[model samples]
Target: MNASELQDIIAWMIDGARSAPTPPQMMAECSERLVRAGLPIWRVGVFVRTLHPEIYGRSFFWTHGGRVETGTVDHKILDSPEFAVSPLAPVFRQGVEVRARFDDPASARFPIVEDLRAEGATDYVAVPLINTDGFVNASTWTTRQPGGFTEEQLSAIRSIAVPLARYIEIVTLRRTASLLLDTYVGNRAGEKILGGQIRRGHADTMDAAIWLSDLRGFTALSDRLPAETVVEILNLYFDCQVSAIRANGGEVLKFMGDGLLAVFPVDDYVGDEAEVCSRVLEAARESRAGVKALQFPNGDDVERFRFGVALHLGRVLYGNIGGGDRLDFTCIGPAVNLAARLEKIASRLGRTVVASERFAGICDGGWSDLGEFPVAGFSRAARVYGLHDEISAAAN
Candidate 1:
C-alpha cells in the first residue's frame, strides 16, 4: 500500500493488461506470480462467465491450476447470486476489476464464505478478469487455507486482474482463429470429422431409429461436371439436406458425399417410428425440393434428385465409430443395416421412399402395399412399401 509498492503494482498491471501473443499463457503466469507473492493459497481456478460467441454462453468449468478441483466441483456457483450477478458479473461485464475475500463474514453480499462453510471452503479470494470487450472471460482465485484472506491480499490480487483479462482475450482469439482456419479448409474438414470418433462396436444398444438416404446417380453427375462445379453443387445440396434433417429433429450423423446417415432417438428427444418417419419424410421432401431448384454453371438445367429412404427403429448404440486412428459419429445395429437395404430396394423398385414392415406399420396408413421382396443379408423376405401417395398428399 506504500507509494513505491503502489507504483510497482501499477507497472505490473499495465504489462499484464497490454496485448500479448498468448492469453492462456498469461493466465498461467499470473497464477504463478500470485502464489509466489506470499498469497495464502498456491492453486487457482479460472471460471469464464459470458454470453459472447453464443457457443460459450453456458456457465461451466473453464480452467484451473494443477491442484484445484475444477471439473469435479458443482455448478451451483453460477446461481448463488454472490458470484453470478454480483459485483463480479457487472465488473467483468464492464471490463473492470473486482477483488473480494470470502473469509469475512461481514461481506454478506458475497456468498463464497457461506458456500465455503457449507462446502468446506476454509479460505478464498477472487478477482474477476474482464477483457476490453466487457465480457468476463475468467475469474481468478485462491482458496483452501486455515484463515480467510485479508483486504491487503485482495487488493494485491485485484491489481493484477486487468492483465489477466487481457491474457484471456488473446488466448480466446488464438483458439478461435485456429478452429476457424481448421474447419474452413479442405483437408482439415475431413480430419475433424475423423477426430470425433469412438470404437466401431461402442454404439450398439440405445433406443434409436436409423434413417439413411442417398441421391441416385450423383456419381454420374460428378463425372459430368468439373471438380469445382461438383464441389459447389454438393455444398448447395447438403446445405438444404442438413438443414431439413436438423429441423425435423434428426441429427445428421454422417454425410457420405451423396448419401446421408441420420438418427432419431425416441428416448432422447423425439420418439416413435411413425413420428420419426413423418419427420424423415418431410426432410427428404424438402431436400428433393431444394436440390431440384439448384442451377448448373452452364446455364443449362441439372437433373432433379431421385433419392431412396429407409427407416428402422430399435435399440442401437450411437456414437463415433472407427478404429485406433480414425472415427466417425454414426449409429449401428441391425436396424441401420436393414434401413440401408430397404433404400437399395427402393432404388431398384424405382420408388422415391421405401420403409420396412416395422416402419410401414407405424406410419400413417398412407402407405399402401408394395409386397415382400427377398433382400440381401436377410434370412426372410422383407415386406416393403412405397411411400408416395400419403406423403405427397401430406405435402399438398
Candidate 2:
C-alpha cells in the first residue's frame, strides 16, 4: 500500500475504535484495514493465560477475523501453550520487524503457525501488541496469501501498534474494574451479615467514618411486585445510592440486599468532626431525597430510604475475608456494627438522622432530643441524637 493509503487505513482504524460497540468490533475493523492494506488472511485477537498457571485458564481473550476462521481455533488452543502468550513466548521475540518466511517447522518463533499450517495455513505474519509496561497482550496479523508480510508491512503495522495496544488496555481495564466492583460489593455484604472484618485489596487500612443505609418497607414492596420488577427497582435504587456515595468522597463497600455500606476515610479526613458529620449527613439526605424521584415500569413510586448514619472516629479493619475461593472487600469493627444498629434505632425512633453521642459531642448544630438509650449488645446506654439539618450539626 502507498503512504496515503496506509495513513487512511490508520485513520479509519482509529475512528472505528472510537465508535466500536465492543473491543472485538475494533479488532474486526482493524483486520479489515490490514486486508485493504494488501495483506491476505486477516485474523487478530488477544489471549491471556490464567495466573495460577495450574488453572491454565484463559482469563480473557478476544479475536477478529484475519487468518483463522471466526471460531475454528477451537478448545485445544485455549489452555495449551500451542497458542501465543506474552513476553516469555511473544510472537515478536525481538523488535517489531519480525519475519519468518521459511515456514521453519523447527523455528521457535511461530509455534502456533505450524499447527495452523498442519491444518492448511502455509505462511502468515504476527505482530506483538505490547503495553507501555511491556506486557504482551497478543499479536495482530494477516494469513498466507502470496509473498507473506514484507519488511514494509511490519513497518506499517508498527505505526498503528500503540493504538491497538490501547484498545487491549481498554478491555483489560474494563474487566479489572468490573471484577474489583464485584469483589468490593460482595465483601461488604459478607461483613455486614457475617460479623467480621474484610480489608480492601488495594489499600492497607483506611481511617474513616463508615455509613450504613437500608430501604424502608422494601420487604413489603418486593412482595407487591414481580421478582423481575423487584430486581429492576433494587438495581435502580442502588445505582442512585452508589452514585451518591462515591460523589460525596466515599467508597460504597457493599449493598446489604436492601441496604448499603459506605465510608469516608479520616485519611482524606477533610474537616473536623463537625465537617465530617455535615458531609456524611448531606450525603445521607441526598440519598434519601433522590429515591423519591425514581419510578418503576408499573408507575409506582420507588421506596424511600431511612439512613442510620453513625460517624465515629475509630480504627476498623478493612479487607478481603472469606473462603480461599472467594474474597470480600469490607470494613469490620465495633464502629461499623454500631453504625448499623444506629440505623435501626433511627427507623424505630422515627428520626431521619441518628448518630452516636461520641460523634455528636465533637460537632456543632442540627441535633434534637432523642436522649440516651441502652443499645442492644452494648453494656451502657449509648448517647444518640437525631439530625434535623444535613450540615451545621454538633455530635455531642
Candidate 3:
C-alpha cells in the first residue's frame, strides 16, 4: 500500500468526513479508499453501539465493488450465542484486535472465520475503534486474496482506526440525538428544533384538529396505588393514546400529568378540515377501545381504567415559549384551551369521547349535539357534541 494513499484516507477522516453525512457513506468512502491504497481487503465492516432504549447498535458493511449496506441490532442481540462466539466479543469488550489466517492451521476458531473461509477469505481481522472516552466499537477487514493481507497492509489498516473512530462517534452522536428527540418530542417538532427553531417566541399558527385526553379518576387512583403502579398505569394509558395518535397522523405534543395533548395538522393550506376531523375521530375511537380493553391487575383483580377525549378544530400557536434561557417547544392557543375545557365537560357528562361543535360539524356523521353549556373560560356557552354510541354507553 502506498504511504500517500494511507495519508489520503486519514486526511479525509480529519477534514472531509462531514460531506458523508452518515456512517454508511463514510464506510463506503473509507473502504473504497483502502482498496485504492492497495490493501488486499474485499470486505469492511464498522459496528457502532448506540445509546438508545431499544436498539443495540448499527452495522455498516462495505464490499470491494458493492455499495455500503446498513442494518441495526436489537438489545437482545448482545446476549445471543452468535455474538458470544464471534471475534467481535473480545475486540469490543477488551479493545483488542483478533486475527485469523485461514491459510494457517493455528488461526482462531470462530463461526465467522469459518464462514469467511467458505467465501475464499484467507485473512480476517477484527479491530476495536476505541473512542476518546475509552468506549470500544468494532470493525472488521477480510481479504479473499490467496496470500491474504501482509504485515504492511495490516499496519496501514490499523493506522486509520483512530480517525475512523472519531468520525463514527460524531455520526452516531448526531443520530442518537435525532432518535431521542423524535422519541421524547413528536417528529414534526423534533425536525423544527433540529432545523433551528430553538429561540423563544418563535412560533407558527397551524390549523389542526386538536386532541386533549385525560384519565378519569387518575388523581384518586394515584393516591391509593403505589407510585410505581401509578407510573405503570400511566404508561399503559399513554402508550395506547400516543400510538393511536401517531398512527392516525397526529403528533402528541405534551403529556400533562394524566392528560395528553396532540394535534392533527391540516398540512395542505387548502386541505379539508373534515379529513383531519375524520382522522382525529378515528384515533379517538381506537383510543377508547384500547383503554376499555386494558386489564391491568392490582393484587387480586384488574384495576378499572376510564378516560376522556376532546377533539376540536382550530388554529394554535405552535412553538417555543418560556423565560430567558429556558423554553418549551409546544402548542398553546384558544384551541388547546377549549379542548381542555371540553375534556372536563366529557367527565361531567360521563362520556368517553366528546368534541367541540366545530369539530363535530365537520365530520360526516355520528355526532349527537350535547347542547350549549357555559364552559369555565369562555363568556358564552359553548356547544359540545359526543359520538352517538359513546354518549349512549355513558362511560366505559
Best by lDDT: 3
* Residues 1-396, model 3: lDDT tens digits: 889989977988988476677667878877877887788889998899988888898888898889998899999987999989888999988899999888777675687877888788999989999888899999999999888888988998899888988887777777887888888778889999999999999999989989999998888888888999899999999988998999889998889999999989997753578877888888989998999988677678777689999989999999999999988889998889999999988888888899898888888659888889898778888998987776444544
In angstroms, give how far residue 250 of model 3 lies from its true place.
1.1
TM per candidate comes to 0.52, 0.52, 0.92
Could you tell me which 10 consecutive residues in candidate 2 have the lowest summed lDDT?
53-62
Scored by lDDT, model 3 comes in at 0.87
Model 1 scores what on Cα lDDT? 0.61
Model 1 per-residue lDDT tens digits across residues 103-163: 5555566654565456545555445666676556556454565565666766666666565
Candidate 2: tens digits of C-alpha lDDT, residues 1-396: 567767876776555467667655665665666667665544444443222312332322222333323222334554557445422244534535344453564444565555555655445555666766776655545445455666676677677776776666656665554454445564334434344333335324556667877776688777778988888878887876677766666777777788887887664436655577567767766766777566655455544443344555556777666666577667787788888888877777765556677666655546765777767787877777866653322332
The true-versus-predicted C-alpha distance at residue 175 of model 3, in Å, is: 1.8
lDDT score, residue 127, model 2? 61
Among all windows of 10 consecutive residues in model 1, the one with the lowest summed lDDT is 54-63
Q: Which predicted model would earn the best TM-score?
A: 3
In order, candidate lDDTs are: 0.61, 0.60, 0.87
The clash tally of candidate 1 reads 9
Candidate 3 residue pairs in backbone clash: none
